[model samples]
Target: MRKYIITGLLVWLPLAITIWVLLWVLGIIDGVFVWLLSAVQAVLPDSARASIRELHNIPGLGVLVLVAALMLTGMFVANMFGQWWFRQWDRLLFKIPIVKSIYSSVKQVSDTLFSSSGNAFREAVLVPYPHPQSWTIAFVTGKPAGEVGDQLATLSGAASEEHVSLYVPTTPNPTSGFFLMMPRSQLRPLAMSVDEALKYIISMGVVAPASDALSAHPAKQPAAAESARN
Candidate 1:
C-alpha cells in the first residue's frame, strides 16, 4: 500500500507543482488587467462599463491580452524609428540616478540573455569547485573581455591563453549563484545544451542529461586535479 501511494505521488507531484506555478504567474498577470479594467471603468460611460464588466469575468483573458501586448511591443520595436525612440527612452531612464543603476544592470543582463547575436549561457560545462575530486555543472557565459580578461589572466598566471566566464547556478533556484573565470583549456566543456544543463541543475541531479549527451571537449574526462582552486 505504501509503495502504491509513493508511486502515485511520484507521478502527480510534478504536475501539481507545475500547475500551481502557472496559476501563480497567471494571477500576477491578471492583476494588470484588473487595474486596467478599474481605470477604464472610471473613465467609461455606465453602459460601456457594464459591457466591460462582463468581459472582465472571463478567465485567462488577461493572459491573452498580456501576450498580445508583448507581441505588439516586439513588432513595434523591430523598426528604425522604434530603435531611435528606444535609445532616447533609455537615455531618459539613465538620467534618473538610482533607477539608472538598477535598470541598466537588468537591461544588460536581459540583452545578453535574449539578444539573437548574444552567446551568454549557450554552452554547458563541468568544472571543479570547492575542492578537488568534486565537480559541478556550469554555463559558459562568454569569453572574458578587455580589462576583466587581462586581470583574470594575470591572476591565473596564464596571460597568453583566453579565459572564459561561467555562471554556476544553484539547484532548485538556478537564479542565484557564483560566477567563475577559468581558462578554456582547464575547463571540461560538456555536450549538453543550456536547457538540459538547467534542468539538471534545477533538479539537483535528479534529472540527469542523457548518457550520450555527457561528452567533454579537450579532455575526455574532468580533470579535478588541474581545476583552479580560486
Candidate 2:
C-alpha cells in the first residue's frame, strides 16, 4: 500500500503543482483587472459605476481583456504612427522622476534580452568562477563590444586571447546572479539549449542534461589548449 501510494504521488505531484501555479497566476491577473475597475469606478459618478463593477464579477474576464489588450497594443505598435507615438511615450516616461530610474533600467534589460537582433542568453557553457578549480553553469550573453572590448583587450595583456560575456545564475533563483566575463579559450561549451541550462541551474544540479549528451564545442577545448601552448 505504501509503495502504491508513493507511485501515485509521483504521478500527481507535477499535475498538482502545475494547476496550483496556473491558479496563482490567474488570481494575480484577475486582481489586477479588479483594481483597474475600482480605479475607473472612483473617477466616474456613482450612477455610472455599476456597469463597470458588474463586469468585474465575470469569471475569466481579466485574462480575456489582458490578452486582447496585448494583441491590440502589438498590432498598433507595428506601424509608423504607433512608432512615433511610442517614442513620444517613451520620452514622457523618462521625464518622470523616480519612475524613470526604475523604468529605464528594466526597459534596457528587457530590450537586450528580448530584442530580435540581440544575442543575450543564446548559448550555455561552463565558466570557471572564483577559481579555476571550481566551475559554474552560465549563459553566453554577448561579448564586450567596441570600446569595452578594446579596453578589456588592452587591460588583459594577452593580445591574441579573446573573451566572452557570461551571466552565472544562482541555484533556485536564476533571476538574481552574477554577470561575469571569462576567456573564450577556457570555456567548456554545452550542447544544451538556454532553457535546459536554466532548468538545471534553477534545480541546483538535480536536473541535468542526459548522460550521453555531448558538448556543443567539444573540439574547441583541445584547440584552445594547443593555442595556449603555442
Candidate No. with top TM-score? 1
Give the alpha carbon lDDT tens digit for every residue of 169-189 in model 2: 888998899988778888887
- Candidate 2, overall lDDT? 0.86
**Candidate that would win on lDDT:** 2
Candidate 2 lDDT score at position 183: 80
Worst 10 residues of 2 by lDDT: 212-221
At residue 206, give the lDDT of candidate 1: 89
How close is every model to the real structure, measured as TM-score? Answer: 0.88, 0.86
Error of 1 at 125 (Å): 0.6
- lDDT on C-alpha atoms for all candidate structures: 0.84, 0.86
For each candidate, C-alpha RMSD in Å?
A: 5.1, 4.3
- Clash number by candidate, in order: 0, 0
